[model samples]
Target: MAVTDVTYTRHSAEAAAGLMDELCTVYADAYGQVAGEDTTVKADAFRDRATGALSARNYELVTARADGELVGFVFGYSLRQERDWFAGLDPAPEAGFTDERGGERTVVLAEIEVRKAWQGQGVGRSLHDTFLGGRLEERATLSANPDATATHALYEGWGWQRVGTKPGRPGAYYREYAVFVRRLPLLDRR
Candidate 1:
């Protein structure tokens, strides 16, 4: 389907709640097999966090709907002193990062998911492309389960490079998932 045919737009706080649930449902379904023991709990926490982020305006939630039905979405925000999208940890004291890039250098992209039924239909790619094109960042980063080969391939196929990996929690045998980064050209000035 044409990208324009799929309506992509920013969602308001009220609309975000329902969209967040759909996002979490898709997330749990995607990661449940890999996440043990606390799948629902963790997914619910993620949903709550997404909601909070939206409510605080820290993150922008963009949803894609085809024929008026939500099919895919992305959530992210401008990087601040205390908020880093991927790691969720404060940057190192000596990291030399700042959120004051005059609206130019935003580190974002916490999560992007497309419903299973919509996979391989260019929906995910459409969302990714739209997000990158819409943001002002020089680069975007994301962490993906290393064992999620398909996901990795998708990123790589889109010209994202694998930067590094981090260890997984105990009992999660799939340790050290890969981190991907993609440098994007500045959005059009016009």
Candidate 2:
């Protein structure tokens, strides 16, 4: 997957509703072998979460293609006050950190990845920039495994700031992921 051969596309989560199968394939192919994880199971879970996100208010997907083949994608949705994504935080974040009264307050960037052959050459960055460039949100947030240093490095180089870390609990072991935040540029309307 050469950088010059790539093209990007944006789709509303509704328009991308039927793409779970393909998206799962991309996810498995990107994370399966390296992580020594079961591809099918991971894909299944991803499909379920993605479906839920699709039904959410303002979910979006950004895909990257190389010669019209799916090479990578980034997907997430706007965070809302009604959602309890922040409730599980151990030490908790600043007061009103999860507040989303205006709906566009923050976007929870859920996932992003590129095929192995295409990584380290800017495909991920391109996909990320393309995904976030047009957002109207005030900021963006994401949670990532604390051990995934390389992934964190990529995000840090791109301007993400670590806000805090969450600890694992019995019912929500994955809460150990570190939370990161980055302010998004507001497009001038004046």
Candidate 3:
């Protein structure tokens, strides 16, 4: 299917809950099975966090729907302090670029997922464009697993350049995660 059939919208807190569920399901299907761990719990926790952030007006959840079913989503928040949704987590060095933009900034894409069935369908790209395109933030950043070469390729294809990598947790199957950054055009200027 063409991306044109996908519709993007800013989801309300209530709507975000459903979208987050789909997001988690996709992530678990993509990353959990190979790791020999159940990520349903983690996914649930992430959904709660996303909902809380949206309720607190700290982030916005953008969802893509096709045939009235949620297929992909991107969750992000405006940065206001030193710590954020991913606080205390060992972020890759390049994640630093996201913090360089002070005052009315956006920090962290808590999650972005597209169902495995929808992989390579341009749904992820559509979500990214709808979520980040024309935003006024000076820059945006994301941390992706280095082992996921396809994901790295996707981000790089979208103009997000890798700036650094961080060591992974002990015994973790993935060795390190890379941080990618992309500068956005000023909204007013655009």
Candidate 4:
């Protein structure tokens, strides 16, 4: 099932909220295939996070569709000093590394998903690139389930570096995640 004619669209937080149901459906479809995860539980957590993200300043979302069906999406927002995305990072980076300094330094790659059938046909890459390409922030960061080998590989291949590990948010999932960072403007994404 190759999605040869997929279209990617960018949406602001408000616009994305209007299509929340469709976005969650695609998220659930993508989450359903992850090994060692409780699909229902994770999906619920994602919905909660997505809703909160909608209110974050500078929120941005990019969705990929093929044949009128949502197949994938990637979204995140500017990280402010108050956000504390790295609050629980084990063996935290040196001082000043995690500082957002009023949200001018880093943007987060909060979530990226591609339906199972569209997993490897460039849909994920397209959504990722489309979402991050326009970010004016100096860097970007994301966390992935360490066991998701293919996903980790994809991020590394796209110029992301494994920084450290962090435990999932207490109310989200009970697991450790590998943190990754990438410089912005994504110069190497070819």
Candidate 1 residue 138 C-alpha distance from true site, Å: 1.4
TM-score of 2: 0.89
Candidate 1 runs further than 4 Å off? 1-5, 12-15, 28-39, 55-58, 84-104, 167-175, 188-190
Model 3's lDDT to the true fold? 0.67
Q: List TM-score per model, in order.
A: 0.72, 0.89, 0.75, 0.89
**By lDDT, who's the top model here?**
4
RMSD for each model, in Å, please? 4.6, 2.3, 4.3, 3.4
Error of 3 at 70 (Å): 0.9
Relative to the true structure, candidate 1 reaches a TM of 0.72
Q: Residues 70-151, candidate 1, lDDT per residue (tens digit)?
A: 7788877665544433342222222533343554465567678777667778878888887777776677777777778887
Clashing pairs in 1: none
Error of 3 at 25 (Å): 3.5
Question: In model 2, where do residues sit more than 4 Å from their true spots?
Answer: 34-36, 167-175
lDDT per residue (tens digit) for residues 1-190 in model 3: 6778888888666666666557666666544454665666666666565666765434677877789877777777655655442333454334554353453565466578887677788888887887787356666777787778888988899988776776554553357667666777777853
The Cα local distance difference test for each model comes to 0.68, 0.80, 0.67, 0.85
Q: lDDT: which is higher, 3 or 4?
A: 4
Ranking by TM-score: 2, 4, 3, 1
